[model samples]
Target chain A: MEPLTLDEKIRILTESARYDVSCSSSGSSRSNRKGGIGNAAASGICHSWSADGRCVSLLKILLTNHCIYDCAYCLNRRSNDIRRVALTPDEVAELTINFYRRNYIEGLFLSTGVVRTPDYTMELLIETVRKLREEHRFNGYIHLKLVPGADPLLVERAGRLVDRVSINLELPTRESLALLAPDKSREAILLPMRQVSGLITARRDEGRRAPPFVPAGQSTQVIIGASPESDLRIMTISEQLYQRMGLKRVYYSAYVPVTGDTRLPALNSLPLLLREHRLYQADWLLRFYGFTAYELLEADAPNLDPELDPKTGWALRHRQLFPVEVNRAEYEVLLRVPGIGVRSAKRIVRSRRVQRLRLEELARLGVVMKRARYFLTADGMTSGEADLSSERLKALLLPEKKKRSGPEQLSLFPTNDSDLSALTGEL
Target chain B: MAIWRYDGSFTGFLTLCAALLSQGEEPEEIISAEPLQNDLFRTIISVASDENRGEKMLAAIASRISPDSCRLLWQAFLSEAPGVELLLWRYLSFGRTTGVKCDRFLAHPAVGPVHRLANSVGQEAHRLMGIIRFQETAGGQWYALVEPAYQVLELIAPHFAARCSDMNWLIHDRRRSLAVAWNKQEWRLTRFDAQGVPPLSADEKAWSTIWRGYFAAIAIPERANLRLQQQHLPHRFRKYLTELEKPPRR
Candidate 1:
C-alpha cells in the first residue's frame, strides 16, 4: 500500500475531527501584535457552514488517526480497520498558516487520537501550536485538545499559547466510560479540566495587564445517546461542570455510529440529532436564560419534549407563571416569557423606559412573538387569546406540517428560518 | 414643500441634515443628486457637501444622543436603502429635540425604520465576514470578491486587516466597483474593475481540491439539507467561493 500524502492525511484527519462538534471561535480577544500574522475576534467568526449545517469556524483536524486504545464509538479506535496517518508538527503549522493566508479558516482545531502514549501526543500538540505562535508568529484562534492524563505543566504551557483548550468527557457517567473505553478513566479527564479551569481563574485574577491564559476558556464535549443517560442527567452534569469547573461550553455531539462493536449501538441506529438539538436549547437556557436544570426537567419526565421547544415545554408545565404583562414585567420576568430571548428581553427593558410598549411594537424590539404571544400581555390587552388551556396553546405553538402541494416558500431572511435552527441548535 | 438633494456620500448626507435643521425647514424628501428625480410642486434645494457642517451634525448627535446612536446613523447611511436619507433626517431631528433619552425609544416612529435599516446592514456585513472566500493568485496575493446587498466593504475591511495582517489581500466589492486592499501594515479602499480569474499556483489548486473534498466528506449523509445550507450561505455568495465552485472537467 502507498503511504498517504498531505491531501489524504487532511481528508482522513478532518473526517475524524468533524464528529466532535465544538466549532465556536468566539469569546477570546487575542489581538494582532506587531509582526504577527493574525488576531482573534472577541465574538468569534464562522468561516463557513458544511452541508450538515454545522459551523466550520476553524480548520478542525487531528494530528494523527492512530490510537493506543479502542473507544467503541470512535471511528479512529485502534480495532477499526481504517487508513492511519499522522502529520508532523511543522506540517500542521504550515497547513494552518497557508489556510489562514487564503482565508479558508479562522485558525486550527488540533485534536489527536492517542498515539504511542498520552504524554507523547500532548507534547506533539503543544509543539504544533508553539511553532505556529513563536516560530511562524501566527496569532489566530487555536483550540488545542488536551490529551487526558498528560502532564499539567504541558497543559499550562498549552493554555498560554492557544486561545481555547478542551478535553472530551465523551460519556456522561463513569460507568459508561468504563464500559466503552477501558483505557480512559473519568478521573483522567476531570483532572486536566480542573487544572485548566484553575489556571484560567488565576490568570483572570491578575489584573488586565497580565497576559491572557486560555482567553476563550475551556470547553468539553459529551456524546449524547451513545450512553443511556437521560436528558435530565445530562443537563445536571453540564450544570455541575459549568458551576464547578467553570467550563465555557459543554458541546453535545449526537452519537453517530462509526463502528460495529456489539457494546455500542447498532450501525443501523439513527443519530439522535433531534435529541441533541433539544439538549443544546436547554443548555442555552441554562447558561443565558436564568433557568436551572431542575426547572427544565424532573425525574418523572426526564426527557425533553420532542414536539415543542424546551422553553415552551417549561412554560406549559408551569402555567401560573404566564400572563406577565410585557409593559410591567421586570427584565428577569420578561426573559421568562416564552417568546422573548435575552436580546429581546434586554431591548424590552430598555424600550419600556422611554414609553410604555404596545403589542404591535414587540416585533420591532426583537421579540419572537410567535411563542411569546401566548405567555404575556401587551399593555392591558391579552394577545387576543385569553385564558387558553395549556394543551390548546401547545397545539398552536407546534410547527405546522406542510399541506402537501409543495414545501412552503423558503424565507428570504436566512437567520429567521432553517439556518437559524441549525446555527442555534434549536429544533 | 421643499426637497433637498446632495451628493450621496455620508458626509454629504450629514451636511444636508445639518442645513435642514438650521434653516428650520421640513423637507418633503432628502434625495442624493446622482439619481435625482424631479418632484412636481416642490422646490428642490441642492445642498453642497460641507465638511464643517457634516462635522457639526456628527458632533451634535454624539453629544445629544448616545455615541451608539451616532454609530447607528453612520451604518444606516452606508445601507444605501431607499429613503434612508429622509429616515436619518427624521431620526436626528427627533433625537435633537428629545435629548439622550431618545436612544432607548426603539419603537419611536422616527427611530424604528433607521434602526431596522442599520441592523440589516450590520447583519449583511457580519454574514459576508463568514461567506467571503479568498483564492491565492500567482502574484502571491490573496484575492476575494463579494457582492453584498449593502456597502459593507468599509465595515468588513478592518476585520480582515486585523486577521490577516501579515499577508497582502484584496477584497473587491464588484457590485459597487470598490475594493479594499491590505498591504501587510495598512489598508486602503479604492475603485476596482472587474477582471477574469487570475491564474493559481499548483499547490493552491491542490489545497482547494482537498478542502472541497474535506467539506463533502464531513457532511452526514442522513442529514443532507440543501435548504439549510442555502439559508446560511445564500446563492449570491457562491460565485467566488473556491470550495463551492464546480471542479473543472477532466
Candidate 2:
C-alpha cells in the first residue's frame, strides 16, 4: 500500500479514536512559558462541537491503528481488516502546532492501539507528547493515554510530561472483561491508574521541587451496555475511581457496536445514549452533589429510570427528604432538591444570608421551579401541587415528550440538554 | 421629569451619573445621544464624557460598594442594551446602602437587571473566546472575524493574547467595526473596516480542508443529534466557521 498522506492519517486516526470519549481540557492551569505558544484554561475551552453534541476540546487522534490485542467490541481490533496507518512523532507534533495556530483545537489528545507491545505503544505516545512540549515549545493542554500493560517507568514518565493522562478500564467487571476483551486483565488496567494516583499525591507532598505530575490529574472510560453490568455497578466503579484512585473524571461511553463477535451483544441493541446520559448525571451527583452509589440505586433497582433523571429518581424514592426549606435548609440538604444544582444551591445559601428566600425569588436565582417546587418550600410557603403524591408528582415532572413532526424546529433556547449544560457548565 | 443623554461612552454615562447624583434630581430616562434618540416632552440634559469624573466615580464604587460591582457595571455597559445605563445607576445607588455585599442580593429588583446584563455579556465573551476561528494570512498573520451579540473584543482579547503570545493575530468584530490586534507582544483595540476575504497562506486551504474533514469524521453517525449540535454551535455562528463552510468543487 502507498504511504498514507497526513490528511488520510488524520481522518482515519480521528475516526478510530472518537469512540474513546474523554475530551476534557480543563483542571490544568498550565501557563505559557517564555516563547511558548499556548496556555491551558482552568475551565476548558471547546473550539467546536461535533454533530454528536460532544465538545471538540482537543485534537483527538490515534498515534497508530496497528494492534496486537483484538478486543472484540473495538473498531481497531486486529481481526477487523481496516485501513491501518501510523504517524511519526514529528508529524503529530507539527499537526498539533498547526491546528493550535489556527485556533481549531485547544490542544492534543493522543491515544493509540498497541503497535507492537505495550511498551512500544507507550514510547510512541510519550515521544509525540515530548516533541510537542519540549521540541515545539507547546504549552497547550495535552491528554495522553497509558497503554494498559505498559511498564510503570514509562507511565511515570508520561505522567510528568502531559497535562492529563488516562487508561480506559473498558468494562466494569472481571467476568465481562474475560468474555469480551480477554487480552486485558483487571490488574493490568488498575496498575497504571494506582501508580499515577500515587505519583500525583507524592509529588504534591514533595512541593515545588518535584515539578508537576499530571497537573490536570487522571481520568478513565468505562464502556456501557456491551457488558451486563448495571448502572449501580458503573456508579460504584466511578465513585471508587474518584475517591480511591483520586481520578479527576470517569467517562462513560455507550457501546457503539463496530465488530461482530459471538460474545458481543446483539446488533439490534442500538447505542445506549440515554443510559450513558443517565450515568453522566449520576456521576455528577456523586462528584459534586454529595450523593453515593448506594443512595442512587439498590442492588434490585440496578438500572437508572429511563423516563426521569437520577436526581429526580432519588428524590422520588426518598420522599422523607422532600419539602426541603430553602430558607433554612443546610447547603447539602438544599443540593438534594430535584431542580436545584450546585450553582443554584450556592446561590440560595448566599442569597438567604441577606434575606429570606421567597418562591418567586428562587426562580430568579435560577431554580428550576418545574421540578424544585415539588421538592422544596420557600419562606414557609409551599408551591402549587406541592402536597401531591409521589406518583402524581413524577407524572408532573416527567419531561413532556416533543412530537416528531414534519421538520424539527430548532429552539432558540434549547432545553433538551439542560441537565448536561448544568454538568459541564458550558453553553 | 427630565431625561439624561450621554455621548454613548461608558465614561459619558458615568459623567451623567455624577451630574444627576450631585443635583439630587430623579432621572425619568437615560438614553444614549446617538442616532438622535430624543423626547419632546421632557427636558433633555446632554452630558459630556469627563475622564476625571468617570474615574472618580469608579473609585468611589470600588471603595464604597465593591470592585466586583465596578466590573459588573462595566460589563453591563459593554452589552449596549437599551436602558442599561439606568439599570447601572439604580444598581450603584442600591449598592451605596447595601455595601460590598450588594452583588449577593440577587433578589433585589434594582440589582437583578444589572446582574443579568453583566452575566449575559460575560457569558457571550467566554463563548466567543472559543467560537472565534483564525486562518493564517499570506504575511504569516492570523486573522478571524466575529459578530458577537455584545462588544466582546476587549473582554476576549486578553485570553488570546496569553495563549498566542508569540504570534501576531487580529480578531475583528465586524458588527461593531472594532478589532483587537496583537503584535507578538501587546494588543490594541482599533477601528476596522469590513473587507472581502484577504489573501490566505498557501497551506491554509489544505489545513482547513483537513479540519472540515476531521470535524465530519469525528461525529458518531449512530448518535447524530442535530438539536444538540445546534444548541452548542448555533446557526448564527455557523456563518464564519471554517468547518461548516462548503468546500469548493473539483
Candidate 3:
C-alpha cells in the first residue's frame, strides 16, 4: 500500500471530522509572545463559516482516520472499508502553522479516530500540539480531542498545551453507548473528562500565576437523535455536566446518517436539526438565562416544542410569569420574559434607572418587542390587547408558516440573497 | 441655525465639536468638507482642524463619560453614517451634562442613533476578523484585501498583529484606499495602492486551492443554507475570500 499524499490525508481526515460540530474558537486569551507565530483572542474569531452554517473557527481535522474501535455511527468506524490516512506530528504542526500564517483558520481543532490504542492516539495528538507550542512557538488557540481511556498524565500534558479539550459523549446514555459503540464504555469517556475538569479547577484555584490547564475549559458533544434518549434526558445530563463537571459548553450535533446499519435510523431520516436547534436554545437558557432543566421540562413533557422556541414555550407553560412590567421588574424577572435576552434584560435594568421606560424605549434597547409585547408592559400599559390565555398566546406567538421560505438551495458560492440571520445562528 | 463643516478626519470632527461647545450654541448640522452639502437657510461655518482642541475634547469626554464611551464615539465616527457628526455632538453634549450615566438613556434622541451606529461598526469589525483571508505574496508576506461596510481597519489590525506576529502582513481596505502594514513587530496605517500587490507564487496558489477544496468538502450538502452563509458572511466581504472566489477557468 502506498503512503497517502498530504491532500489525500486531509481529505480523509477532514471528511471524518466534519460530523463533529463543536467549531467554537472562543474563551481563551492566549497572547502571542515575542517569537510565537499566533495568539488566541478572548472573544474567539470565526475565520469562516462552512456551507452548513457551522462556524469555521479552526483548522478542524483528525490526526488519522484509522480506528481500533468501531463506533456504529462514526464515519471512520473500523468496520467501514474507508481509505485510512494519518499525518505525522511534523506534518500536523506544519499544516497548522502554515494555515494560521495565511489567516485560513483561528487555530487547529485536532480530533482523531482511536488508532492502535487510546494512549497511542492520545500521545500522537499531544506531540502534534506540543510541537506546535514548543517547537514552532505557536501560541494560537488549540481545541484538542482527548481520546477516551487515555493515560491521566497524557491528558494533563495535552490540557496544558491546548486552550480547550473535549471528549464526545457520542450517545446520551450508557445503554446507547453499549448498543451503538461496543468498544467504548461510559466510564472510559467520563474518566478523562473528570480528570480534565479537576485539573482546570485546581489550576484556577491555584491562582492566575499557576500554569494553565485548558484555559477555555472542556466542552463535549452529544449526537442528537442517534439514540432513543429524550430531550429532557439530554438537557438533564447537560445541566449535570455544567454543574458537576465544570464544562464550558455542551454542543449538540444533529446526527447525519453515514451508514446503513440495521440498528441505526435510515439515511433518509431528517437530521433532527430543529431538535438540535431547540436544544441549543434551551442550553443557552440554562447557561445564561438562569433556567433549570426542571423548569424547562417535566417527565411527562419530554421534548421541547418544535413550533416555538424553548424560552417562549417555557413562558407559555407558566403563564402566571407573564405581563412582567418592564419598567419595574427586577433583572431576573425581566430575563424570564420571552422576547428579552441577556443583553436586552441588562439594557432594560440600566436604562430604566435613568428614567421611566415606555414601550417605545424597549425597542431601542434591542428588545424584540414583537415577541415581548405579549409578556411585558411599560409605563403601566400592557402591550395592547394582550392574549392572557396560554393557548391563545401560543397561537399568537407562533411564527407564521407563510413567513418561512422554501428549503434553502445550496449554492456553490455565497449569493447576494443569502440571509445573514439564518447563517449566523441568530435564530 | 449654523452648519459647521470640518475636514472629515476624526480629529477635525472632534475639533469642531469642541469649538461648538465653547460657543455655547448648538449647530443645526455638522458636515465633513469632503462630499460637502449646502443648506439655503443655515449659516455654514468652516471649522479649522485643531489637534490640541481635539485631544482636549476627547480627554474631557473620556473624563466625563467612560473610556468605553470614548471608544464608542470613535466607532460611531468610523461607521460613516449620514449626519453622524451631529449625532456625536448631541451625544457628547448629553455626556457632558449627565456624565457617563448618559449611556443608559437609550431612548434619548441623541443617544439612540450613536449607539446603533457604533454597534453596527463594532459588529462589522467582529465579522471581518473571520472573513478576511490573506494570500501569500511572492516575498512570503501575507496580503489580504477587504472593503468592509465600515472603516474598521484600525479595529481589526491589532487582532491580526497579535495573531500573526511572526509574519510581515498587509491588510488593505480597498474601498477606503487605506492599508495597515505589520512589520513582524508593530503595525502602521498608510495610503494603499492596489496595483502594488504582487502576484501569488505557485505554492501559494496551490495552498489556496487546497484551502478552497477543504472549504467546499466540509460543507454538508444536506444542511447547505446559503441564506445563513450570507448572513454570517455578507457578499461584500466574500469578494476577496479565496474559498468564495470562483475557480480559474481551465
Candidate 4:
C-alpha cells in the first residue's frame, strides 16, 4: 500500500526476483558477519566482462518486489507472503555507486513489479537507471528488466539505456497462460520482447555511433514445469526464440510455486533446479554446439535422456556414427562427438598441422578421454577394445550415472522445445 | 663444457644464448657462475660488462638459430638457472651439428630439465600479474606488494603501464628486492629493498560484506560445482577475500 522502506524494498524485490532465473549469478550465498555491511563471498559467482573484457561481478538487486498480477510460478506474484520494499531512484543509484566505487560489483541488476500500471513502474526503473548513468556517471555494466506489457515507448527508451534487457515470457504457452496465469497473454509478453529485439536490430543496422542499445542483447526467462509441455516442446520454443525472436538468451527457471493454487501444478513449488541446469546445457548446445532442435528431439520421443547430456545421449542413440577419426574429421563431424567442445575442436585442428595427432595429442589438447575415446580414432587407432560396444560404453562411461538428471530439464529449443513446437501452428 | 655468466636480465640472457649458439670451436661449455654453483659442472667464464659483445652475441643467435629457437634460449637464460647458459650452449652446439630443432626441445628428453628451469621464471611472471596487490598511495602513486617466485620485476613493468594507463603505479617485489615504476608514459626498473611495506588498509569489512553478498548471489546452488569453482578460484586464494570464509553449502 505505502511506498516501502529501503530494507523492505530490498527484501520484497530480492524475494520476487528469486523466481527470475537470470540473476543466479550475483554470487553464491555466505553468512553475514556481526558488523559487516554486505556479503560478496557466500556461495555464488557473478562474473562480468570488464572494459578490458574481464568478467567481473557486482551486486545485483531489484528496487522493489511487489507485483500486481498473480503469476502462478512467481515468488513476487500478487498473493505471495513476502515482505515488500521499494528504494527510491536516488537510493538505488547511491547503493550502486557506493558498491561500484569500492569495486564491489561489475554493475547493477534492477527489476520491478508492474506497480499500479506497467508504464508507471517502467518509468520508476528508467528514472533510477537514467539518474545513475547521467547524473552519477556510473559507467559499469547494468542489466535492466524490460517489464512485460510496459509501453513500447518506455521499452525502447529503456532498451537504449541498459546494457541488457530481459522481458520474461513467464509461461511457455498461451493455453497454459489462460489455465495457470490468467492475466498474462501471449501477445502482451511477445510484443515487448519483439519491440526490444527490433530496437536492438535497428540500432545495430544504423551503426550506432555512440553507446549501443542493449549491447549485451535481450534475454528472456521461461518458468519450466509450471505448464504441461514436454522437453521436446520446450526446446522447440527455445529454437524459435533464437532463430525467429533473435533473442540472446532464453533463461529457463524451473517452476518453484510460492502459493497454493489448485489450478497450478503442486510439484512446481521447489526450484526445478536440475531441470533448469539441463535446459541451460541444452540451450548452449543449440547456440554454440551447432545442434538442431529436430536432431535433439524425435516425433514421439519427448524428453532428453536424463542419464547423459544431450550431446552424449545423441552419440549413444546414433552409435553407427562412432569412431570419428580425429586426424581427418571435419569441424562439423568433430562437433558431433560427445565430449569435444569448440575449443577442443579448434585445438584438434591446430594439432593436426604440427603432428599426425596420436591419441595422446587430443588428451594433451584437453579432450576428455573417458567420453571421447569411444567416439574418436586418434592417428589411425580406434579402440583396441572390440568389446567397447555402445551399451558397454554407456555402462562404463556413466557407471555413476545410472540415473539420468534431466530431459525436460534441458529445454533444448526455447521457442520450439515445448508447447510452441507442437502448436508451431506457424511451422 | 664452459659457463658464461650474465648480469641477470632477459636481453643479457638473450645475448648469452646468441654467443653460445654461434659456430666456431663449439661453445658447448656455457654455464652461469653467479656465486651459485653450476649444475652442469662446466668451465665458468664470466664475460666482462661488454655491451657490444652481448649485443653481437644476441644478434648472432637470432640469426643462426631460428628466431623461435633463439627465443627459447632467451627464455632459458631469463630463468637464471646456474647452467641454462650451459644448457642453451649444449642445445645450440647440438643444433649446429646435429640439427636439434626448437620444437624437439619443447618435447625433448633434455628439455624437461630446461623447461623446469624456464618455468621458474614464467611462474614469477604470471604471479606478479595476479598476486601483485596494488594500493592507493598518499602521493597519487599506486603501490603494489608482490612476492614473485623469480626475478620478474623487469618483465612485468611495461604491462602495468599499459593496463593502468592513466595512473602512476609502483610494483615492489620484496623477495626479489626489486621494483617497477610507471610514470604515466613509460616504465623504469630499480632496485628496492624497503625494510617492510606499510600495512595495507584494505577495507576488509566493506570488501567482506560485498564479497559475501557477491559470492552468495552469483552461485546457482543448482549449478554450484564446488569442485569446479575451487579449481578456477582456489580455496587458498579465498582467505583474504570477503566470501570464502563462509561454510560450504550442505
Per-candidate TM-score, chain A: 0.94, 0.95, 0.94, 0.83
Candidate 4: segments with Cα more than 4 A from true spot: A1-19, A23-56, A208-211, A257-272, A386-388, A399-427, B1-9, B23-40, B44-232, B245-250
**lDDT (Cα, tens digit) per residue for candidate 4, span B1-44:** 54456665555655555554453435544433354554565666
DockQ-based ranking, best first? 2, 3, 1, 4
Candidates 1 onward: DockQ, in order: 0.57, 0.62, 0.58, 0.11
**What is the lDDT, from 0 to 100, of the residue A249 in candidate 4?**
75
List native contact recovery per candidate, as a fraction of 1.
0.64, 0.71, 0.68, 0.01
CAPRI band of model 3? Answer: medium
Model 4 TM-score relative to the real fold: 0.73
lDDT of 1 by residue, A1-427 (tens): 8987777888888888888788878888788878888888777777776786666778888999899988998999999999888899999999888778777787889999988888899999999999999999998899999999999999998899999999999999999999999889999999999999999889978999998899988899999878789999999999999999999999987777787788877532232666777888899899999899999999999999878789889888888877899889888888888878877888888889888888888988878888888888888877678578877888898978646553222221335532221242111
The most accurate candidate by DockQ is: 2
Query: Which CAPRI level is candidate 2?
Result: medium
* lDDT tens digits by residue: candidate 3, A197-312: 88887887899888888998989999877789999999999999999999989988778888777888764333277777789888989998999998999999999987888888
Q: Which stretches of model 3 miss by more than 4 angstroms?
A: A1-3, A267-271, A403-427, B34-42
Q: Cα deviation of A52 in candidate 2 (Å)?
A: 1.4
Please tell me what DockQ candidate 1 reaches. Answer: 0.57
lDDT of 2 at B102: 94
Top of the candidates by lDDT: 2
Instruction: Report model 2's TM-score to 2 decimal places.
Output: 0.96
TM-scores of the candidates in the order shown: 0.95, 0.96, 0.95, 0.73
| Ranking 2 against 4 by DockQ, winner | 2
Query: Where is the poorest 10-residue window by lDDT in model 2 chain A?
Result: A418-427
Please rank every candidate by lDDT, starting with the best. Answer: 2, 3, 1, 4
Model 2 has an lDDT value of 0.86
